[model samples]
Target: MKLLFCVYLSVLFFSLFSCQNDKRVENENSLSIQREKSKLVVEYRILSNVKYLEDRNCIEKLASCKNPKAEVRFLFPKNISELGLDTAYQEDSYFIHQLGVFNKPIFNEDENYRIYVMTFDYMVSLVVFEDKRTKNRTFTITGKAKGIFWINSSYWIVGNDCHMGCSMSIERIKDPKLLKPTKEQNLDSLRKQLQRLPYEEKMKIVRQEGDELLFSANDTLYNGIGKKLSGFIPYQNSMILVFEQYKSNKYRFIQVNEDKSVEHIDSLVNGKFDTRQFSEDDMITILPKNQSLISLCQTIFKIENDTLFVYSLR
Candidate 1:
């Protein structure tokens, strides 16, 4: 009877502890959700559709078309027009895709700054555009880079070099003038360390060590969501990761907060959309002014027949 009483007491103690732990986790999750909901008050609106057509003379694809021509009828918001895009813009030699998507515009966290990749045959350059509302300045980085990421308040470039296989470099404002290039002393060691990190997806650096190395944010995101990560958008202190369901047309937009809490933001069902073709930055445009108001715009493009239709989701 004494041994039975001891076992019963032990079971009671374990059950109580387990319930308390469960409540703690539940409270934490509830707090995270409340915090997220307060800040992420997104207002959705649909803008007018803009259309573009392929040139009748060009026989090849738009990428190869040297003289790509399209009748451009762009209708954008006033803030987008503030970026110096003329609403009545018409194309003679270059199409809309050639200027925007083809060139590749990589936007930073706040969207105040952007880097445009300019490729001319064998030569490639990065054009950095800084918008201060009053004064807009542009600078150029003359080189080829496999990938460029705005990591830890600095632009890290994975340079493509055939000599040493490849190299890494950092560009930051040194004297408050312009972005200056800084070379790492130990390239081989840094490369080796980065290679050792267990990265399941490409270019999604979720983890970071010191000032240079970066790793995946969450391992569970890789295994739980899908085998492939479409892309991610960095918003404030959280990251909105996109993943397509396996063997399905559905896409999941997941938000991972700073406290490591995961939440599902939204989902999209489109058969023609493929994340592999474009980066998240390319697909979505977040303006700085609208972000402060908790009102931002998302643009989605669809091509039917030979005409391109651009839809704005605000």
Candidate 2:
């Protein structure tokens, strides 16, 4: 097939890297970006006492430091667009950056927005900013390629850790920018078709159209809560709560009614088309073609600063 899948991943990578010789990571300099004097709170359901952060990069080495290479130059967050704020999500064919530190909360005590999505490259290539004090912006919208093993996006695709005598393959990317997913195998075939089903009424999820592979025949449809949409404003309307009135109010879409009432809903993501192409990676990909948005997306929401964080996965 692909040379018998690279000779069956070189006999499963030395029998799984010699029984997973992990040795507590923290190796260093495969890339390098460590600048987090503070930021690692974790746990946040929307807001029952909010908190969320745990980026961990270094190409999924889980940021013990190292992640983002091409030798590191413009890898990410160097003054992130000068923080003029309001770019919420940028993905010029994969230089990604979703910034929104807004009122500051890189570690908490919130005003909200501790989001900072950063993906390095996939290349259509072009960068000629001869600095007139001009920061880089360049461009590229869709040259296809962002990430999913060959690392990058959100991270971790490391796989094949069967106790190291390793020979499982699929990490090859000696550079060409990155991402060469070679057919992601739909979440590894929906984790082997969810091990023949019935894991407590189902919960598999690969659907975001990256290549279907679903399941949710009712774990009460994900009962209640779930977060990670990243850096303010991620409304797709499974029932209500939308925003985007100011800052480039591209066709309205409010809806804050409780009693104070006010419900507009104009061009919802360009005329009723919100498959949600935004991602600072709170990693959510379960729309199994919309079965009432899988129990209202487990009912979550979090729009900071202007405040509005709800939760309900139960």
Candidate 3:
């Protein structure tokens, strides 16, 4: 009788513990971080039945198949429009590299326009979009682009002018005409000035030392995160880092502010955690006031599953 009672109590405790663990996992899977005042919402949209041209399997198929072009269709999620994507979007190349890998989209201060420096085989294209609509693609420029930034109510493009003995050109494009460069100037003085910008400064400090992560903001040096620092991005006055805790086998997203305060943004288990997905390369558009949206595409070529992750923070 007593033995039976002990066994029953043990079983009940185990069930309750399991239930709690399951609930925690479910919360993490939902990708919504509920804080006291604000909520961070994450949406994962799958682009199914497609593979990149450079993918191992796709390359194998290209070698064996007679047809040079693979008839691949990218099926985006229904809610992609909300994530600032056009459902009827068309690309010149079927290569995934041309789509989203190297091109880092930048948003204007008003958040109305999203600009992309798309690289083609021959030349690079400067594409802009207003909301979910294609605003214009006529701003395409030649030569390799270093970076594009929005500074002082205009878009600044920095690129190498190999035609001019490998010198760099800093071109500015203002409103009315999105990217009609007024003039090309030497890059030495301007490069230093641009680095002093708050956004640029914050990006410089998020680095890794050996296996430990380090971030310095406003003279406060933050270190000792975990084995690997997956990625980080500057948000307002804070920098958010995705850290992989090898000992616990978990991933944590931590926000460190200029005031030396730290906040826990989110966490995920190692198995389901996405690494090398959050960085400056990902698109980030700041909404009108107090809210921002970040989008990243994750592709698994083996499974031919591509997902676009949109994270909304308020």
Residues 1-314, candidate 1, lDDT per residue (tens digit)? 99786565344322221222321233223213423431332222234332212221211134433544322212233344443334333112111223332343433333445433332111123334454452344433322333344433544332221111111122222121243221322323323343354433101221111112211222233344543444443455444444556667555555545444666653453442333322222222222222111111234332233222323432
Between which residue pairs do clashes occur in model 1? 45-314, 206-215, 206-216, 206-217, 207-215, 207-216
Best by TM-score: 1
- Estimate every model's Cα lDDT from 0 to 1: 0.33, 0.21, 0.32
- Assess the local accuracy of residue 65 in candidate 1 as a C-alpha lDDT between 0 and 100: 39
Rank candidates by lDDT, best first: 1, 3, 2
**Residue 275 error for model 1, in Å?**
4.1
TM-score-best of 2 and 3:
3
RMSD of candidate 3 to the truth, in angstroms, is 20.3
Give me the displacement of residue 230 in model 2, in angstroms: 12
lDDT of 3 by residue, 11-113 (tens): 4322221222321233111223223421333232344332322232321122223433322212223344554544343221211221233333333333546
Residue 11, model 1: lDDT of 43
